[model samples]
Target: MTELKQERAIRTRTRIIRAAAEEFDAHGFAGANVASIVERAGMTLGAMYFHFKSKEALAREVMNSQTEVIEPLLHSEGLQRLVDITLVWSYALRDDPLLRAGVRLAVEQGSFGLKDDSSFRRWERAMTECLEAAKKRGELLDEVEPALVAQFLVGACTGTQLDSQLSSGRSDLTERVVRMWRYLLPGIARRGAIAAIDLDPGRGRGA
Candidate 1:
């Protein structure tokens, strides 16, 4: 395809994805309708079909794109960076329809017969990388295992956000995440390092 046509196709695909995210987030997989997504995207059925063959394909794309909102933290290292990333993610969970939809879809995918663990594995890998850096820097306890800690962090954040969403539509997720780190750090960090790490829940966003 020519440059112009390729750009247009990309734009149309993005529009369909965003519209599908909105529909999925609001109504979930079973309730979401392709016609509504096409209408919301202001695109014809052919355009959506050209990019995504089915709703399951669109959902897979959404799940695979779950890391987009946390793109800002992809290169960050250390325990502090981990806290910052989770806080940023909690905020993104509240403010980004695409992320919220992706997470919700991932959690509910079993019901839809669309199983994919790549997103969850990615989260674990990212956390493990950060924890490894923190361990190398002497920020964590000598006995702390990066892989275990990474798993714990992912599970904690997932459950915390799920509860926050259920209770307050995620309005207070940042605070909840802050509490999570506050509760978790004492057990994982070195005595001197515990007090130094920033768990502000507002670090990455300039708050």
Candidate 2:
């Protein structure tokens, strides 16, 4: 394929994945039917497999892609970026089906235990870099371990999500999660880092 053709191919693949994401969200990973996903994408089973080998594989790719988008946004401009990351994640956790599905799938799988996923190594690396930058800048406690901090943050966020999924959204998981994180991270974050979280987008930091 030419460059233009290849780009189009990539876009088409993205569309298929996005469509599959909704299906996965509605049905969970194992329950989501491939033909339904292909049909929703207006593509054939062969075409679906052309981009992803199987539903399990596609779900993994979906989580992996979310990590890519979220990782950069997490490490932008020091503490401000961490706040931005949390805020972005809060809204996304509530509103974005792909993110919700990944959380749900991870929970429903039920065999991973409480240990951090070494399988999500790329995600761990990204968090390590961000946390190390904060530590170097004195935005985090001096003795803090970045890997442990990363795993703690992940658990706090994903655990909330898994709990929410089991009973629907009746318990206000998002609010409770943000509150818990505020307490957990501030203990380790600089004073400035704690205050850096008020980025309200167009309304200024706290207007």
TM-score of each: 0.88, 0.80
What's the lDDT for candidate 2?
0.66
Clashing pairs in 1: none
Error of 2 at 195 (Å): 4.1
Give Cα distance to truth, residue 106, candidate 2, Å. Answer: 1.9
**Top candidate, metric lDDT:** 1
Error of 1 at 197 (Å): 1.2
Worst 10 residues of 1 by lDDT: 198-207
The local distance difference test score of each candidate is 0.84, 0.66
Candidate 2 ranges beyond 4 A from true positions = 69-76, 111-122, 167-171, 199-207
Put down candidate 1 lDDT per residue, 98-155, tens digits, no spaces.
8899889988898999778887877888788889999999999888999998888877
What is the lDDT, from 0 to 100, of the residue 89 in candidate 1? Answer: 87
